[model samples]
Target chain A: MLLRLAWRNIWRNKRRSLIVIGSVIVGVIATILMDALQNGMIHQMLFNQINLNVSNVQVHKKGFKDKKDINNFISKPAKVETIIKNQPHVKFYSKRVITFGLLSSTDNSSGVYIYGINPSQEKSVSIISKSIVKGKYLDASDGREIVLSKALAKKLNVTIGDKVVGMANTPSGSIGSDVFRVVGIFKTASSEFDKTTVFIPIVSAQQMLNIPGKIHEFAIITDKYENADIVSKALQKKLGKKYEALSYNEILPLLVLQMDLYKQLLIIVNLIIALALIFGIINAMLMAVYERIREIGVLMAVGMKNSKIFSMILIEALIIGVLGTIFGIIFGYGINALLLSGGIDLRWFAESLSSFGVGAIIYPKISLENFIQIITIIPLVSVVGAMYPALKAIRLEPVSAIRYV
Target chain B: MEIIKCENLQKIYQDNGVPVHALKGINLTINKGEFTVIAGPSGSGKTTLLNLLGALDKPTEGTVYFNGEVLYKKKRRELSRLRLENFGFVFQAYNLIPVLTALENIEFSMMLLGIPEKERREKAITLMEELGIAELANKRPNEMSGGQQQRVAVVRAIVNDPDVVFADEPTANLDSKTGDNLLNLMQEMNEKKQITFIFSSHDKQVMERAKRLLILKDGLLEKDN
Candidate 1:
């Protein structure tokens, strides 16, 4: 009966109730969509990093990560490959001999990290093969053929079939150099990565750098990106002391830190919205209580307990909050579903986004965790907002209230 | 048998730092099954005395007893329980909770007493039938006429079968014919069920129909019969 009374009382002034409900609806929708956008952008950045060349995990021969010296090569490649193949989570692995060298053309010269890759093995581990912009991917049969990023190709003033020389120091302290014809040009989300990296057949790179059968790193892709740390740990434990197995997070600490900072910013945004919503609910409920002063007095005079009165007000606010949250979820999820197909285009901010390795179009991802959290929180906030007004209603003196005009 | 006893009931007010006495040392006793009127002009303490007797307000310098129990000595929560179980009120404005239908208003007091819904509903409908307002059962206070709202208020008061039903100017807002009809209904309930009916009013109809009358002048009891 108290519930019935509360339910009826709210509708007595329909406009006021709707205003409160409207504010809650706005708060819910704002939180949901903001979280979706942020999550989408972060998810894209992480996915691009993993897909490009990082794969899920990387194995370096101990000191190679700190210094890409040709002497720090993996001497026992066969042993590491055997152990990696035994791991259940390993989907694919590519052996690469990586060294920082210089590439020179007739028009320009730039320093680059030349990746010595087996074409067939690299195709399975890196998305560079699929990101070919002008020419075909690297092929095993094409000796002295190189894959250059479009930015690097432009920087060198070269095109497909153009010749460039790659030069690097060998273990014997002498410069070893090779002339290669650019067979492919690719573009990626990050212009920086695109301009600073080049790939060639492992045989040709070993010959050019004067090292044979000496691997530098093995990039491994796991069955799922989320299991990268576990797979990296297991491999690190088995291949102890001689190798360092690093997950995507360990390999890109700055990116991981930025993602964490974004999540914290999201929490702060939600708190601001909640604070504004609390004030809205409190103001509306206080007005409602004051409007019904005489009625409340009559209720008290007729023997309704103060606690009952307090609960009645609280229930009214809860109903308003629940109603608004339901509509907000419907609309929030509706907008997300509509945008999930084509995605929201951030081409307007493409330069800034690509600097962080995020694509132009972003698909908003939904999490049931976020929805469930907001669903429960809105009504609890409504109850909290109503506390003051409910207390005020209970504090009125019945005798004076009955006579209140 | 005495249902209510008041002793030297003094009620004072502070109107802008000056003490205004609404009631001054008036003693009275009301018996069971009595239809009584406390009559006076404006500022004559009629409503103040009624509020004291009904346990709606505390007296300035005295105490009230209901069926030999000290009314004001109990806690505030206990007073609420006492009112729910033993007393009912009819205001001059026909104070039915505007959100509720007439039937709901009539069942409200019984609901506070924790009566079963079916029992309370049946009791409310039966009382509405007795008062001849059963057809207006589903109408809210705004939808009903003044007379109909007041009839609903009266049913709400007595539906709990309280020991006393207090009516403050019950007919002040109605036409003569409607007011008399309301009075006739209360008079019948008082006579048949022995529910004590105490009223504070200046209306001649209420004064003439009372089995006993107490008149007040300038916050003092001037006559009693």
Candidate 2:
């Protein structure tokens, strides 16, 4: 009987209930899309950073990263390569000989970090081979051929087939100089990274620096990002004292910290939305309570306890919560599905987004966890909102309450 | 037999900090099978005396006893339960719950007592048949005529077969004919069931019909005959 009474009480003022439910639906949709959009952008930024440079994890000689000189080459590059290839969940890895050098053309000169890579193995870990915007990429068999970033090429006033000179310190404490033709100019999302780096065949770099059969770093891409830490730990133990392994998170701590801060800010945003909903619902419920003051007195006079009255009002609030939540979840799912399928395109502002290292197209992700979390949160808001009104209903004195207008 | 006793009962109203006594030391006793009325003009404390006797309000200077148990000393929850199990009420304005139908109003108190749905419905239907309102069972308060709503209110008051029924200006909203019919119905029920009935009214016809009448003047009991 209380359930029937509660259910009927909710619809007595149809327009007010509808307005509250509408606001709840709008809030749910807004939170869903906003969360997804933020996730999409941040996920893309992390992904780009990982693929462009970090991969999932990296293995480096003890001192190679701290000092980019050729003297800090890996102790046994072949042995480490064979061990990694045999490890479980290891998708692909590319060995690279790295050095910092000054590259000069007839017109200009700029400081550049040069990577000497095997053309075949590098493709599995990154899309560098596919980012070629001008001329052809270097072949493993070809020496004295280099790929320069478009921004770096422009800065040096060089193009495909233009001759450039590179100078770096060799392991023997002698200056190594080589003349090379810029075989390709690539454009990645990051203009800064593009302008500061160049790539050449591994053999050419080893020969130029007078260091044979040596490489500085091994970039490993795992089957999934979740496996990165596990593989890094395993590789660190397997590779022993010769090398150190680090996951993408360790390699990019600042980005990880920024993502964590963003998640906390989203929580604050959700709380603010809940507070707004509480304010909106409390007024409507209070009005319902006041309008039925005499009715409450009648109930009490007939032996209905204050606790029973409290339960009745709470049940009414619960009905509103159920109604609003049903609509809100459905609408949120519909919007999430649409966005997930046809990603929101920000191609018009691609240049600006690229500077932040995020992709132009974004597909918002709504996990089951987030959906459940949001649904759970909304009902609590309803209960909290209805408490004050329910208490007022219970506090009525039957004799005088009957006289209340 | 259940008995209600009121000794030197007084009720004071504080309006804008000025104390006005509504009941001034009334001594009264009511028995189980009596049909009683408290009659007076406006500001004569008829309603106030009824409210105090029914355990709906407290007295300022005296005590009310229900079957040797002090009414004023019981907690609010206890008093509410006492009313739920032992008393029923019919008000002047046909105050049926607007959301409920005639049958639901009849079943309201029984429902509060945790009566089973099948049994409560059966009891409600039997009472509706007795009152010639069986056909109006599903009709809401607004859809019914004033006489019909008042009849429904009377049915609701006695539905629980309570030991006492308090009717305050029960026929104020009804026409003379409907009021007479309702009074006859109450008289018949009081005789047949031997359940006590108490009323607070200024109507002359109602005062004449009462088996016992308590009249008040200027917040003091003037006569009990």
Candidate 3:
């Protein structure tokens, strides 16, 4: 009977009930959309940073990460490649020898990190072949050819089919210089990488550095990202401590930290909206109590207990909360689907997002946990918010209430 | 055979720093199966005395004994139980829950007593019929006439078969004709069911039909007839 009374009372003032439910729905929808956008942007950014920039796992010599000395190159590359190839989860692997060098042209000279990779194997591990915007990527038959970023090529006043001189320090403490033809101009979405990196053939790098069969790192790719840790750990245990295995997560700790901060900011915003919704609900319920003062008095005089009155008000709040949450979920997902299909182009903020390795276009994506949390939290907040008004209504005296308008 | 006995019942009120005595050392006794009317003009403490006897309010300096138990000394829950099980009230405004239909209003009391639905419905329907408002059972309070609403209020009060039915100006909102009819109906119920009816009213017609009348003036009983 009390539940029936509460159900009837909710519809008595349709506009007021809608206002309360509307506030809650707005909060829930905002929370869901914000969560989806943040998670999606983070996922896209991480995918680009890991798959295009860094491989799932990179094998480097122990103690070489802090100091990239020329002497730290793997002396036995064939044996290490044999073990890595035998791993069932390994989809693609390549050897890269990286070193800091100076590239000089007629007008300018700047420091650059030169990556020496096997052209055929590099395509299996990284997307560098697809990123070539001008000329062509280096091939096995193309001797002494290099690929320079568009920004770096422009700064050095060199283009495709131009000659550039690379100078670097060898393990013997001698300066080695080599002339290479720029065969390709690469344009990555990231400006920092485009300005600093130059790629050359692995055989050419080995001859210039005087390390005939040595490479600095083996970059491995796996089909599943979650398998990165497992493969890395298995390789570490099998190869002992001679080689260090690094996953993308360990290589990009700063990105992980930034994602955490973004998630925290989203949570704070969600809480503020939830608090506003709770206040709106409480206000509506207080008005409802005031308007039904006489009715409450009659119930009390007719022997309805104070607790029953309190529960009835709470029940009304619960109903409003549940209905609002359902509608909010639908609205939130609908808006998310619309925005996801028609991607949000942040071209105006392209520089800002690209600095963090994220694309200008963001797509919203929601997980099961986010949906479950929204479904549970809205109703709980409603019930908790109803406590004050319910207690106030219960404290009213029968005689005084009967006189209220 | 006294159902309600009050000894030295006192109630005081503070009116802008001056103490106004509402009930001053009053003593009264009423027997079972009686139609007792407490008659007084405005500010004569009739409602205050009725509130004490109905267990709705406590006396400031005295005790009220009902059915051999000290009503004032009981705990709040016990006082509520006493009101639910023994006392029924009809106020001047009718006090029918505006959201509920007349039938639901009568069943409200029975519901609080934890009466099952079938029994509560049967009793409420019979009481509404006895009050001659069965046809108005489905009508809300605002949809009904003043006399019809008051009759619904009467049905709600007596639905639980309470030991005593207390009404404070039960006919003040009705016309004289309806008021006379209501009073005669109460008198007939009192004679037929042998249930006690105690009311505080200024209506002369209500006082005339009472089997026993107590008139108050200046917070003291002026006459007992």
Candidate 4:
């Protein structure tokens, strides 16, 4: 009976009830879409870093990543390869010799981190082979061929078939120099990374630096990137404390921090929307209560308890909230589905977004957790909003209230 | 047998910081099965007396007893329960809930008492039939006429078989013919069910039908017959 009364009471002023309901619907949709957009952007950023450069995990000699000195090269490459092959999750691994060198063309010179890689093995670990924008990737037989980013090519005022010289410090404290042909130029999502990186055949680099049979880093790709941390832990334990196995999260701490900050921003935005909903609902319900002052008095005088009166008002508010939320979730998910398929095209801001390693198009994604959060929050907010009005209804003196117009 | 007893009933009101005494030093008792009327001019404390007697308000000074038990001494929750079980009220404006049908309004008090739905519906329909407003059962209060709405209010008041039925200016909004019919119905119910009926009114038609009359003037009891 109380439910019936409450349901009917809400319709007493249909326009007012709908206004409150409409505001609630808008709030739900805003929160859901905002959260989905933030998640989609962050997810793209993380995957781009992993696929383009970091692979899933990396193995480096102790102190090598900090200093990048020629003397800190991995001496026993065969032992590291044996342990990596034993890991079940390892799908592909590429060995590379890394050095900071100055590359000079006839017209310009720029400092770059040069990676000496086996062309076929590097393709299995990273997407650099597919990212070639100009000229062909380097071949295993081509000793003097080099592949550099478009940003680096532009800085050096060089193109394919241009002659360049690479110079770096050798392990013997002597300057090692080699002449190379620019074979390819590639572009990646991160412009900052593209501006300072180049690749050459491993044998050519080792011969130039006088470090035969030595490599600086092992880039490993797991079957799934999510399993990188588990595989890295296992490899670290087997390889002992001399070597460091680092996951993508460990290699790129800034990207992980960016994701966390976006999540906090999502929370703050939703809280602001929730507070607005609470106030809107309160104002609507308070008006409903005051308009029926005489009816409430009659209810009290006819032996309806104060508690029942309070419950009736609260139930009415909850009905409005639940009804609005139902429609909001339906529409929110519908919009999310449409955006997920077609994606939000942000190519207009590609220059700004690519600076941070995020892709141009984002596909909005929502989890079951998002659904649960919206379902619980709106109805709870409705109850809180109605509390003051319900209390006011029950506090009126019956005799004076009955006499009120 | 006495159903209600009151001693030195005094009610005062504060109108913007001025004390206006509405009822002063009135002693009264009403017996069961009596068709009684408390009559007075405007500002003569009839409504004030009814509110106090109905336990709807607290008197500034006085004690009201119902069936030899002190009415004001109980807690507010206890008073509400007592009213639900033993008292019925008919207001002047026919204060039926606008959203409910006539039958729903009639069964409201029983619904509050946790009565079964089927039982309350049957009781409400039977009472509406006796009052000749059974056809208005499915109609909301706004769909009914003034007299029909009043009949629904009366049926609602007495639906629980309350020990006392208090009517405050029940006929003020009705025409002469409708007011007489309402009075006749109340007299018939009073005699047939042996239910105590107390009314506060200045209508001559109401006073003529009453078996006992008490008149008030200037907040004092002027006469009793």
Off by over 4 Å in 3: A74-94, A118-125, A137-143, A167-178, A218-231, A367-373, B1-3, B15-18, B30-33, B74-78, B110-138, B176-195
Steric overlap count per candidate:
0, 0, 0, 0
Pick out the ten consecutive residues of candidate 2 chain B with the lowest summed lDDT: B86-95
Quick one: best lDDT, which candidate? 1
- TM-score order of candidates, best first? 1, 2, 4, 3
Per-residue lDDT of model 1, residues B73-140, tens digit only: 98889988888889989999988999899999988889888899999999899889878999999999
Each candidate's lDDT (Cα)?
A: 0.90, 0.86, 0.84, 0.89
lDDT of 1 by residue, A40-126 (tens): 888888888888878899998997777888899988899999999999899999999888899999999999999999989998998
lDDT of 4 by residue, B1-225 (tens): 999999999999999999999999889999999998999999999999988888888899999999999899987777777788889899999999998899999888999999999999999999999889999999999998888888899889898898899999999999989998898888888989988999999999999998999999989999999
Model number with the top DockQ:
2
How well is each residue in A1-405 modelled by candidate 3, as lDDT tens digits? 777778778888999999889888888898888788788888778777675657888888886676788888888889889889987688999998888889888889889887889988889887778889999998972379989888898899999899999888899999877889989998765667777788899888888888888899999998798798888888877777988877777777887787778767766776677678788878989988988888787676666778888899999999999999999999999888876656678889988787766778877778565677778777877887888999998888765676577
Ordered by DockQ, highest first, the candidates read 2, 1, 4, 3
The whole-model C-alpha lDDT of candidate 2 against the native structure comes to 0.86
| Candidate 2 docking DockQ | 0.76
Better of 1 and 3 by DockQ: 1
User: Which pairs of residues clash in candidate 3, taking residues 3 or more apart in a chain or in different chains?
Assistant: none
- Order candidates by lDDT, high to low: 1, 4, 2, 3
Q: Which ten residues in a row have the lowest lDDT in candidate 3 chain A?
A: A396-405
Question: For residues A29-126, could you state the per-residue lDDT of candidate 2 as single tens digits?
Answer: 78778888887788778888887777899999876556665788885788999989998889999988889889999999999888888898888887
Candidate with the larger TM-score of 1 and 4: 1
lDDT of 2 at B129: 97
Candidates' chain A TM-scores: 0.95, 0.92, 0.91, 0.91
Superposed Cα deviation of residue A38, candidate 2 (Å): 1.2
Superposition TM-score, candidate 3 onto the true structure: 0.87
lDDT score for candidate 1 against the true structure? 0.90
